[model samples]
Structures are given as C-alpha cells and as structure tokens.
Target: MGAPELMRVSVFKRYLDELAPLDESDPHQLPPSLLQDLRRFKEHGRHTEPLEVLAASMRHLRNVAMHLQDGERVLPLTLFPRQCLAHCPLSLHELLQLPLDNLQVLHVEPAVLRPPGDPQRGLVKALHLYHPLPLLSWEFAMRGSREQLLPEIAGYAAYRASAVLDLRPLPIPTPLRNCVRRLQRETTSLRQLSEWPGLDRAVASRLLNALYLQAGLIVSRSHPAADTDGWF
Candidate 1:
C-alpha cells in the first residue's frame, strides 16, 4: 500500500507548540513577542522563500527527533538560528557579528582553530563573552590546543603490554616513528620481566629500575605514580 499522507502543517505546528510552554514556565523558550513576529510573517505572507524555510525547519525537527529518540535531553539552540538564516542572504561574517543575544546557537569545530585568525575566532570569543549557556557537547572537540593533538607514549605503552605495538603500519613522521619504536622496545622489555613465573623480586626490581630510567618520555621519575596512575 502507498504511504499515508503526511500532515506537514500539523507536524510543524506541533513542534512549535511543544516549544511554547517555556515562555510561561521555563524562560528559555522564544518570547511571546517573537511568536507574534512569526505570526506577522504568516499573515502578510512575507516569506519570499517559504519552501526553503520549511525545508530547513523540517531538517531541524528531524535532528531534534533523532536526539530525543537517543534519550538525549539537551535541545540544540542552533535550530532557531539555522531557521532564521535559511532564507536570509547573510554571509558567515554577517551572521557571526549578529548580536549574541539574538543568536540561538553557536557551533564550533576544530577546523575553526586551524587558520588561527579566521573570523570565527572573534565569533567564538564573542559567544563565550555574551552567552552564558553551556556549550553544546559537540563543542568539546574544538577546545584543545594543537600541542594536545599528538599521540602519546602511554598509548604505545598499553599497546606494547598487549603485544600489539606494530611500528610498520603507522604513518607517522620519521623522527616520531623512530621515537615510538624505541619506546615500544622498552615496553616489550618491561613486559618480558612481567612474564616470569612468580616474578623474582630482585629481577623485577632491576627491571622496574631499568624501566624507571628508560621511561623518561612516558613517566616522570619525580612523579612516577602520576604517570602510572593515568592522571594525564
């Protein structure tokens, strides 16, 4: 049988109504004044691009539905901003400079950090300055500095312990690849010491002593327990 006819207006109106109680109760919903503005748009048929706006709205609603089905509670503030911009001819710069109080959501991604002085830096800083809203969870990936992006010796230590430290496959820079291989060798030696039955105390002590010395990149002797305890 053919699929049942879709209730487009009812579905869209239902989503808007679901969002309406917040004005009277939660304070985060769009104000009644903004709903009045939307009503004006509807009355005057001022939407020169109604189909485009509707498409954007439907997409936003789909994203909300998917998140809800996943048991996620946070509604993205981006939906309203995206809807507003859909039929508007604003550039990214114009959109970024719009008063933060007028914006619903601000999404940031790692690539925004790459260019350093990209216009997005101002937008990101402004968003932090104006909106006290908790950043959407996806924003976390954009939080780290470049130095924190590198692979760490501790990961190779775990790989070595698991007997899986294969250096040939990693497409790392030559110097870093050599460094990791050397660290892997030290990890393998430590694992060998751990393999001995009953672990001779003196041998284990010597092995641990050697590991302590060679583990400079992975562990700090001044703070040995800090590294081993995974505090980083």
Candidate 2:
C-alpha cells in the first residue's frame, strides 16, 4: 500500500510562543458535555477517501480546541486511542505505527475506529473519549515517552494516521518552526518529504500524522508537488 506524500511539520517561529494554541490540561478536566461531540462523532461518519474520512472526525477536534474556554469551545484544535487490550493485544499506538497497508480503519459505532473484531460489550472496549484522560495516561504509560516531537504535537500524533500535511496551531512552548515552515511553503506528500535536509521517511510520516490530528494538514492530490505514496 502506497501512502500519499505527507507535508513537513508546519512550524513557524514567529507564532511559536505568541499564540497559545489550546489548554494543555487534561481532557477530562474540561466539561462532561464536551464528550457528547465525540460521542456523536464516533456514533456516525463513514467515508472512504482518507481526507474525507479524516475531516468528518477532525471537525469535532477543531471544535474541541477553539470552542472550549468560557463555554465557547477551544477549537484551538485536536483529537485519541486504546482499550482494545481485551481480545486484541494491539494498542491503538501500535496500530498507528503499522504501514498504511496493514492499518484497518472500520467505521463503526460505540467508538472503535478500525477493529478486526469488536470486543464484547462489557469488556474493555475501544478508546471511548467519553472519559479521555484515563486512557491518555494509560497509553502514555503503555507507549512510554517520546521526545521526537513537542508534548502537544506528540500527543496529537498518537491518534492520527493519514493527513495531507498542514501546521502547528499557536503559542506552543517549543514550536518546530523548521518543520512547520516547510509544509506551509509547499505542497508535498509523505514520499516527497524525503527531499527535506534532515527528515527521513519515518520522521516525516510521524510529523504528518501529528499534524493531521491537530487539524494542521491539508489534502491535495493534484498539486505538482503532490504524489501518492501508494500506502493509502
């Protein structure tokens, strides 16, 4: 399976600390009502094209970040994974690392993205964002720590897969301006990202995936710089 070329990290030094993206506080600390957006989203949305499917879910994440504070919704923007430990040993983290050919994204309710076998109702179930913090911590412990990207960026990447490549939100502690600048400047796919001075395919993929979750990516199959990685 070939993947589409992913855009590099969309970091801009100017906006690094100037604009606070979203509250880095725990997700559960927000409000109980917030989960309803995720719940309803998980309950519906089934599309085939990677971009189309991603938009369906990411719309809510964007809402979560920018619409949060003062009951306005942070929508500064985002999105998570786990709980399949019952019948399947593959954590959502592991599934994401698999090449796109191996990854399976099923559109089902009860909030399981792509499942080989649905776990029994009473069992551990999927990454139910109804209560997100527990699983976030659990996944962190299970996956260990990764300094490859910023805390915010890494957290976002943990849940995202395919994206067209976009940018960082704002006011991040340590914005990867180099990465962000590259993507913002041109339209490139995952395969084409190798042209960057220091980015390997793996790092490029990780960065693109992270951007996708943060709503920092864009999909364009027609750009002269764009080419499918066949991983889609």
Candidate 3:
C-alpha cells in the first residue's frame, strides 16, 4: 500500500515497551523487586538510616527510565532549531567532543547560523539548525566533510527569510534527498531521524520502515529487498 499508514507514536511506544526489559537491567523493563524498592524509597523518610542507599538506587533506576523514555518520545520531524536545542541541550564545542557514535542528533537554533571558519571534523550523523537572523547575513558552509550542514543551514535560512519556503518534502534537491537516504540507512529510530531538516511525510514513512526492518521491529513476509534505492 501507499507508505503503510504513517506509524503512530503509540505504535512505536508499544514496540519499545515490548523490546525493553522490566528490571534494573533494561530501562524499558522493570522487575517487581526493583519496582517495589523504588516505591519504598520514594515513600520512606529522608532521615532513615537506609534512606541514602535507597535513594541512590532509585536515582540510578530513574536515570535508566529517563534514557529509555527519551528514546521513546518522538519529536515532530519538522522541529525548529530552537526547539531541538531546548529539548537536548549541548554546546557546539561539547557536541564536537562527543564520539561520532555517541552523537545522536545535533539541533541548531536558527539552523542558518553557520559556525565560524570552514566546517571541520567531528560532525554528527544528523544535524538540525535554524536559519535567518534579521541582522546577520545568512551563509552556508558549502564545502566540508559535513556536507549535510549546507542544506540544514539553507533550509533554516529559507524558512526564516520568508514563510513561503515549503518545509514539506515535495521534489527536494538531490543533496537533501541523498542526506535523507543516508539518515534512513544509518539511524535506528524516529527520534534519531527527526534531527535532520526537510523530513516530510514521505521521508518519515521511509525512515519508519527502515528502523522497523533494521531493528527487527517487524517481521518480513518474504525475502527483504536488498536494495531500497527509490523509497525516498
């Protein structure tokens, strides 16, 4: 059928819940004992002798839940630069220092604001920046290892300059088309996919399929196609 009805957040959540473990080992899964302990810790007084240890254990459990929850919550594919940054705070410098594999998504506000100097190393797989400052001149880093930067920069700029720029995917340029394709192949979740610019319904559908297939979230009826060339 035409792009299997856009998968809903609830569906994705259900998938996540199924895959996650119910204990301290898996944030998605919670063991009965751990759950009981967490509840007890929350209810007990702070001055109790065992309170410190219990609170520490609870904190660790909460962290795991928070991480898994972060993975489960999918932001809209068309998130603005400011929104992304606000949701996931990290300075460009701090982000650059992170291992490439560790960098999930980079959200830039006014994605159009290019960092000074030519783009260098330490580019993440997905980037989202805002565009168009009224006073500042809008410029894109057209050349670099991080080529995706240009479109992300440009898309934000175009959006800010005028309201007319179509954020939806409808005959997008080859560069962005290729970028979306790469993201589809490399990323594993919708949360990861939402980091890029210009992801419309078509792109989102393809990405959901890729993630489901790659993660074994869905079983294939027949031999899975080796090539997914034109889905974008």
Predicted candidate 3 versus true structure: per-residue lDDT over 1-232, tens digit per residue: 1221233456655765665333456534445454554344246442211111212222333211111112333222121222212111333333233232221221111122222231742421234322121100001011111212111111111111122322242334576646545643443233334455666434543333322212212222232221222211
Estimate, for each residue in 16-92, the C-alpha lDDT of model 1 and write its tens digit. 56653333334443344433433443465533122122222333332111111101121122222222211112333
At residue 39, what lDDT does model 3 achieve?
Answer: 48
Error of 1 at 198 (Å): 38
lDDT of 3 at 22: 35
How would you encode candidate 2's per-residue C-alpha lDDT over 1-232 as one tens digit per residue? 2332322223222334465554535463333344343344345452222222233334433222111111211111122233212112334443234333322222212232232343554533344222332232222222322213222222212222234432232222233446556567666656666556666765565556445444455656455655545322
TM-score of each: 0.19, 0.32, 0.17
Candidate 1: how large is its RMSD?
Answer: 22.1
Q: Candidate 3: list runs displaced more than 4 Å.
A: 1-7, 25-73, 76-125, 129-232
Worst 10 residues of 1 by lDDT: 63-72
Instruction: Measure candidate 3: CA RMSD.
Output: 21.4
